[model samples]
Target: MALSPQDLHRIAQSRGWRDGRVEVFDTASGKVTVKGLRATRHAARYHLLNGVARLLGLPFLQAAPMPGGRQAQQTEVARLRALHGVGARVPEVLHVDEDHFVMRWLGQDHLGDVIQSHHPQAAALWREAGDALVRLHAAGQYLSQGFARNMIVDGAPAAPAWPG
Candidate 1:
């Protein structure tokens, strides 16, 4: 479902940021999630630092915090659309403005949490996760935030596995 800029703003006002970054808003219409500029800008800084490192003949620098809101959201939307076009599982982008964009709510524990918990199905889960990444890369773009924390698994229980 698409939300207008006003809708996004209204929702943001309703639900404060999570971890001081993401905001999740569930409405009678549908659920919308908003992510701030941290990760996107971090990737930007990574590239900037990477260029400097290359000029100095040094190893690549790690991603650092980037600063910008709307631009970051634009970049993110483009990236998401690209990934979606290539068959990657991603949230549906609803609307975008300068500071943030509204996207269909994708609710689930982060893949990282599940992995850390040693889910009995961890092997299969990891395999599927790796395959998704491979597919995304095969689409000819590297997702800067390709960490397990960024991946969501739908319909999975919020529990850990017992050791066999």
Candidate 2:
């Protein structure tokens, strides 16, 4: 099933956020940050969401800390680091909290906003992003939240391959 906008909204609000807000932050040291308070209900929803994510064989709540609270977040990071062994690419998990995670943010503008222009660089990036998805699926995994923002576009597209 597709992620409901309502699900997004509830999770968003549980973090005390609203539309168009900078729930994300950039510290002076070039580190990126996001802040939210942990909500039990929100965490429950994440648990359900995680079930779907695992079925896809992709990381879920990689950003969410476990129940031991702050300590658990550290464990989550250690667990995700192992994904490179299986060929997964995610931003560096910087710091974790009961409610939020900081990562090495490779920033970008909204793809829709930028897509209107036929920039050669952007087109190449899109194709590469698609290929990344294809690679993940070939590993018997997929992103439960299959949206453009979740993807990180590297320099160029990898060669095409048959989709699973």
Candidate 3:
């Protein structure tokens, strides 16, 4: 059916980013992403479970919930997590669960809009974006997939990363 923040918190072990019906709280706040398989029942859960396990300092799937199912994906997610902060420009990993994560919500703007927009500041934004990319690479982390449809605008900054 659908996944909820509470569900994710139940089985999640760390923090991360999400793809299915997610809500970006502010400049840096992710709740469900920190939770994993229990976080939701969507395609991303499979990858999230794999990619963010190590990012959130949680054990890989083999050492976690399902044991040996999809070890390869798990490895990749671990890579992403290990590279969580290569430079000082990486998104702050908020938390991670079985297959979910939460992170600092970078401004909810996509590359295309940032580049193709008619805004006068688009040019400057483009330059900043270049720097952002370098900084991200320096963080030593690599996202297997994240573009366009990956972002969501949730207005100005809000509450803490997650309620305790």
Task: Report residue 31 deviation for candidate 3 (angstroms).
Answer: 8.0
Ranking by TM-score: 1, 2, 3
Off by over 4 Å in 2: 1-29, 35-87, 152-164
Write model 2 residue lDDT over 68-116, tens digit each, in one string. 4444545545645554447587656555444555555555544433343
Which of the two candidates, 1 or 3, achieves a greater lDDT against the reference? 1
TM-score of each: 0.75, 0.47, 0.41
Worst 10 residues of 1 by lDDT: 59-68
Model 2 clash pairs are none
Residues 16-131 of candidate 1: C-alpha lDDT, one tens digit per residue: 55356678777555887777555434465577787888888876454444445666666679988876677677887876655566678888688887778887777788889899
Ranked candidates (lDDT, high to low): 1, 2, 3
Find the candidate with the highest TM-score and give its number. Answer: 1
The global C-alpha lDDT for each of the candidates, from Candidate 1 onward, is: 0.71, 0.51, 0.44
